[model samples]
Target: MNSNRLPLFTRADNFVKDLTLTSNQLLLIVCAYIALILNLPFLFKSANAITGLDDFNWLFLITFPIFLFSITLLIQSLFAVKWLIKPILIITVIISTLMFYATLTYGIVFDYGMVQNTVESDSAELLSYLNLYAVVFFIVFAVIPAVLICSIKISYQPFLKELFNRITLFAGATLITVLIGTIFYSNYASVGRNNKDLIDYITPYKGIDSIYKFARKHYFYPPLKFQLLDTSPQIINKNNNKHVTVFVLGETARAQNFSLNGYNRLTNRYTANQDVISFTNISSCGTATAVSVPCMFSRLNKSNYDKRLATSQQNVIDIVHLAGTDVLWISNNNGSCKGVCTRVNTQQIATTKSNPLCDGEYCYDEALLQPLREKLHKLEYDNTLIVLHMIGSHGPTYFKRYPSNKILFTPDCQRSDIQNCTQEQLVNSYDNSIAYTDYVLNQIIIELSRLSETEDVASSMLYVSDHGESLGEKGMYLHGLPYAFAPQEQTHVPMIFWASAQVSNSTPDIDLTCLKNKSTNVFSHDMVFDAVLSITSVKSKTHHIKNDPFYGCKSASFVPLPLLESAKKIQTQSSGEH
Candidate 1:
């Protein structure tokens, strides 16, 4: 060989020899690559959604991948034992798959609230979310990488040398990550504050961190104890007239889709024909059943409401029961009343087998009706409060909420995987659920009317949903987004009020005309506690006059409602409901 050629050949041989890696080193590299592949899509989507790929966002896109890579390397190095690699990788794959599936399917950012909901959700509810598409996606993205990692041949090195290399790699990666983070400190902080969901959108790291935080907040933290607002609430009986109030607590019903609220769809057909008063602008306390149910029943307003505090004390049910009225909570929804019904007479329709309307696990909202009628028949109290918590339009299983004969809209999405359906089909399926709810409400009203006629009972029925739902709007589906960032579709709920002639005549000061005018007025979950107390004639110091929708019904001040002025303005733009 020529002298120059020999030197080039020698250098080439040295380069090839240097490329060889020990099993630990190779595993670290594989983990790092997998992490990047799993996280990059999320990072890109989150950055675009937040900052729209502007200069500041570009900086994030460039640095975030590096940060993720370095963190994965550091983690792999710290757990560098030959036996630990497969287990860690497998766990990573599983979690990563779940995170991807949720983010893509529902457009949800896995924040602390999401983590809390996940932990609190039952097996059935969780299983309802699973489908073939999500499984396929998980296999393709997560399982494929894991399989590759497991199949690779690993060359062993001396334990001491491997340990030294692992420590050195971790230290180097940590130093680099810290340096990058420090340099972009201000930019990161600004983006994080402005777009809080960005942090939540980051894959396995965010998911794990949120779960840890949720656990700490719920389990490790000290229990919050608060005084019940109306410990000695009392109902003042006027004329000794028998009063019966049926409070229907609905699930995922939005005002925008209700014909009573000026929507084009005749979703509220039954309620429209009746003398029901529908509120056009009503916002929910929270975007999920878990939070909204407790909040609605609590004296606390949105500004002051704390989940811990809400759970600790007696709510509307306790106060109502204390006021010498028989209170009963009948629920078709799987979720409990979040401790609100702990002291009240509660019946769960989902648990009963004798009711043909129920199938043990899932049931139509009408399933609550039969149980409610039975309870009503046995009621011995002159003044009674019956709460019917309905499972109305809960999705992406909207088709299942209503029976086959009740599906008013054609081309309804039958699949649980809503993404597989067209936008029109999805809307049709959801609207059909709403129509069925209308039918259920009409049946309840008819039952109430029958009781009022047959017995000496003065009756009324009030219906309000726990929270509204998002139906494929801007790539968002379902509810439970954090309240601060949730769109109107997730918060603007429907409310209906109907009173029999006897009950109306007894409370003659509650002007029906004034209430009809105030139907277009803005209100929120904060009004519910006081409104219920006012309607039931439960006098308590805890009830705020300003929060009561009927407080100024007979006064000139009723025209320009105070609550409407103070409440959040409703967004004019509308979206499809679930």
Candidate 2:
């Protein structure tokens, strides 16, 4: 800042040299800075939570220089006439926007998973971009430069000279600001108490695409080596021995919400009436359908799933197809993202179904089962593995999952946003969908039973959800909260099996009766591989028959599967064992 010598100390020189500021402008600048500081937490918290939680410190730690430099530039404009103000303001806007954009890009690269975790799992990118835009607008437009304009100091020089001076001021100010920030940060930092742990927890070790590829390759969570079970049930009394097994893969069905799993409503009455066995304490490896479906099907464990060193080998479905058992994937999901059924045949028309509860909309779970009867009629095979992916209990549109006629409980939640509704209404809508899913499963079983009567075939049905959903508990809506932070509602899913009397009694050597009375101690979506392989008699290298962690671990602890127990342990430890 330079002062020009006044011409003989006249009144005109006084007007030129003396800097003046209105009270309102000063107040506005102070208010803007205060608002920026206050709003910084919410803005940076989400980004940092995604990239690394330590980001909150930068708000106070380094913000001073950014504020000072912007204000310095702003104050310099005071010497310019009203004619030059518009150009100066435009330049300031451009520079601030570019800086904010750069900061957000850096934040996102380190913390994409947090973005993935915060956004609704379906529309993550949109949420991330929107969040960045909001943060940038506040800092650039309302915060920094506003403070500078409030101070009544001004100067004017050639454009090049001004640019050089501005650069010098920015460099000096930034260096000093950072040094002060380091001191402030050191004062506030604490061992394991600050954002350090949060930063580590959310930081992505690998790119998201790499993570996806890794998940698809490993397919198993906490992957253990291929250990085939030692025992196999002998089919000695072989009368009408042709066998047919159906594996129904349900979508987003939480076991806790299922009436069969002890919810108040009769959500699964149809299966309860039949010779169905419900395994209540089952958990999915991952929460998202994309991650969980293929992961459950893969031989790779969860820890090693994303590890570059993990082996890439044949999945359970591939083994089934190789064993000459007809394998069919009938899905309502968007093909599981990885296209786990890419090599295998899949039937999915549910995408086109209109919502029965609303006009011109697709909602009924039964829409997936529409073509099943026709497909089965065409098949001539004696042994078959039909995987039905049910669109069960996916929300915030829980009310649209089932038909209006199927709303068995009174005072139904007509709206999709269950968070705003009464808990009872939410339960009623959710349970009604489960009731409809139960009906669909029962109908498929009845068809299998009819086939068993007419043809020389053994029939059975096994149902497992990819993962569970969460209702409005602890201020969370829908599902797909980060698995570590996720409630039991999202992880604990329902697994059930229906076997005909002939097959049940003949295979009485494998006692499911104990499983019926007590929820199986060894239960997981991982066990689906062993269960299906066991059911189809595909005693191959990929199958596990005995000492299986699939269910019924001979341990004192009531926990069904060791994987679930371990995940719970990991989560507990990370949360300081709270």
lDDT of 2 by residue, 234-334 (tens): 22223436677788888888888777778876788887788787888788877666557776776554543432221234566777776676778876544
Which regions of candidate 2 deviate over 4 angstroms? 1-240, 307-312, 335-337, 350-363, 416-418, 505-509, 544-578
Q: Pick the candidate with the highest lDDT.
A: 1
- RMSD of each candidate? 8.2, 11.9
The CA lDDT of each predicted structure is: 0.77, 0.56
Candidate 2 has its poorest 10 consecutive residues by lDDT at 228-237
In model 2, the number of clashes is: 24
lDDT of 1 by residue, 1-578 (tens): 56466677676555544565566567666766556666665666655653653545566667777877787777766666777766786777678777877877887767776777667666767877878887788888777667655655566657887677677777888897898789877766766767776666677878888888878878898886555554677775656777888999998998888888888988888888888999888999988877888889976677677677667666777788888999888878786676779888898775555666756668888888788789778868878999998889888788889999898888999988998899999999999998999999999999888888888678888999988888989888998887888889999999999887776566423677878888888899989987887677676656666777877663333223443432222101100100
The worst-scoring run of ten residues by lDDT in candidate 1 lies at 569-578
